[model samples]
Target: MNTPFPAIASSSEVRLPTGHHWLYGDLVLPESFSGLVLFAHGSGSGRHSARNRQVAQRLQQRGIATLLFDLLTVEEEHVDLQTREHRFDIPLLTRRMQDATLWAQSQPQLQHARIGYFGASTGSAAALIAAARLGSRISAVVSRGGRPDLAGPVALAAVTAPTLLIVGGADDVVLDLNEQALRVMQCEKELAVVPGATHLFEEPGTLEQVSALAGDWFAAHLSMEHAA
Candidate 1:
């Protein structure tokens, strides 16, 4: 399932305008792309998130472009690191992600591409909220070790995009959280557990499994959106 996407190109330090300021990100585009997925890295993570980057690379191989960006500005991140604030602010993150999504949609390379969301950790909450509010603008969603529960029942119930929640088998608490979130969601959804893997999916082959599942899900839904 992992095949090359033709004419791959990337911008490592893209600056996205958020009205208030600019946030940094990396945008990877492949020729004749099927769709674009925006990564919402977990709290404390940014554009350089290794796990997210791996997933993005795998998606690109399957003809999906990806945008990995900082959810917070540099100053905000510095304060968050010291005060442990802003990371769990789901609304704040949601707004920034929305801006990033709109920004990505407006870019020349991504203009005609369907959009999807790939969320990790608390970022999943923001992604769900953004997806719910944006309606058909987001074609699909996938959560890796994410806390979709934090998005709250109202937001979960409103999401229309097909969502897949992936959790590590060994991460009992988060697995349970995803299960509960799944029940509240009204849209097409699924929960996938990676056997013997932990929260970070550091175990060998676990991340690959995650990547494969994500690529397949996006390829199906995003492709359908493009077709429609």
Candidate 2:
């Protein structure tokens, strides 16, 4: 099925470098667009997850495009879930994110636009690592209930893009981790904790808060002009 927003003209699956496969999301031009957002899901979720889908939908409404892809190949997902070997391989996931960023950079549909990363859970670490590697190419970043600490000091310190870290008040451990990571970030950053929300934000109205915070962060930082 296609995205409901008019701005998203079309969407499709893209194969990357033989082993990697991605859902190459495309949004229709709205006379102009702010930029593209690449989504990185947490453990035990995929591109089609309802939670991430909601966030992506909200971003589309605000003139931001999104790419939500499976970080693992079909076989890899099976092995990772079964044996739990490579899913937590932060470096590997970061590399995949970088490849996707490069792929988006080359596409005519997104060529001139800036790029942002929206990461959740373990994917947050991957996103941070990728943002660090991409440097000035990534315009902004947002983490929802993220494990930013997993990215390690080098990746966190290297990220130059403006970053927003959102955590649920009920998620005490993660909240603390985000706080610790924040101290290490050298770039512009903010930490917002949603009251009454849990780790997965399964409570009513909790996910909405995350969506709102993420939307605002990306909107403020993503440039309308691709060349900007």
Candidate 3:
């Protein structure tokens, strides 16, 4: 796991109720926040994902709040670890993302903030679907080495929020998939290819580049000065 970033203005543990389950998460806020970015990690990963947290930290540094939550319950995660059943359930994950956003909107501390999504791997599909369903509620979206094609063409066409799809140049299959999704998407979008990076972006400086790109994208779209 990557070492966590420096302390922020406020950081706390939150529990979001999704009718049948309570998903746990980490919420980090800066002193004077501009917007909130929700994180959706891939299958077999959750709020504790090092890469996601690193990106979240960068957002916080830019005065953007962040929420990194688990998409599955402990029991479901254990079952998925054994059976790989719920990992690919895009609809289920999409509902979870929607529920989490509603939960954030209901909170006194976060209700007034604009919302965005930062998704990695399969979680990108869930984020895109949720963004499409939420319409103008979502201000921006950023995907890192994600399978956005799993979101399907309809959702891609329906997304109105500006999006940035970041892929590792060495990840040929996913890069092509991102290109296809970009073509289907009618919203403002861009595909960023980080040279020499792989699927996980474990290479030195690659993850940092992802963080920088995501921070800039969210800063541009999630600003309070802009309409959501």
- For all the candidates, what are their Cα RMSDs to the real structure? 1.6, 3.7, 3.5
Candidate 2: pairs in clash: 7-28, 8-27, 8-28, 9-28, 112-226
What is candidate 2's lDDT per residue for 1-228, written digit by digit as tens?
Answer: 965444555556666542434433333344356788988889877888799989888887777778888877777788988888876888878888888888878888788788999999999999999999889999999999999999999889999999999999999999999999999999999999999999999999999899989988888888564234
| Clash totals, every prediction | 0, 5, 0
- Model 1: how far residue 66 lies from native, Å: 0.5
Off by over 4 Å in 3: 1-7
Provide the TM-score for each candidate, comma-separated. 0.95, 0.91, 0.96
Off by over 4 Å in 2: 1-6, 18-31, 225-228
In candidate 1, stretches whose alpha carbon ends up further than 4 angstroms from where it belongs are 1-5, 224-226
TM-score of 2: 0.91
Superposition TM-score, candidate 3 onto the true structure: 0.96
lDDT of 1 by residue, 171-214 (tens): 99999999999999999999999999999999999999999999
In terms of lDDT, the best-performing candidate is 3
Q: 54-83 in candidate 3: lDDT tens per residue?
A: 988888888899999999999999999999
The full ranking of all candidates by lDDT, starting with the best, is 3, 1, 2
Of models 2 and 3, which has the larger lDDT? Answer: 3
Instruction: List per-prediction Cα lDDT, in the order shown.
Output: 0.92, 0.85, 0.94
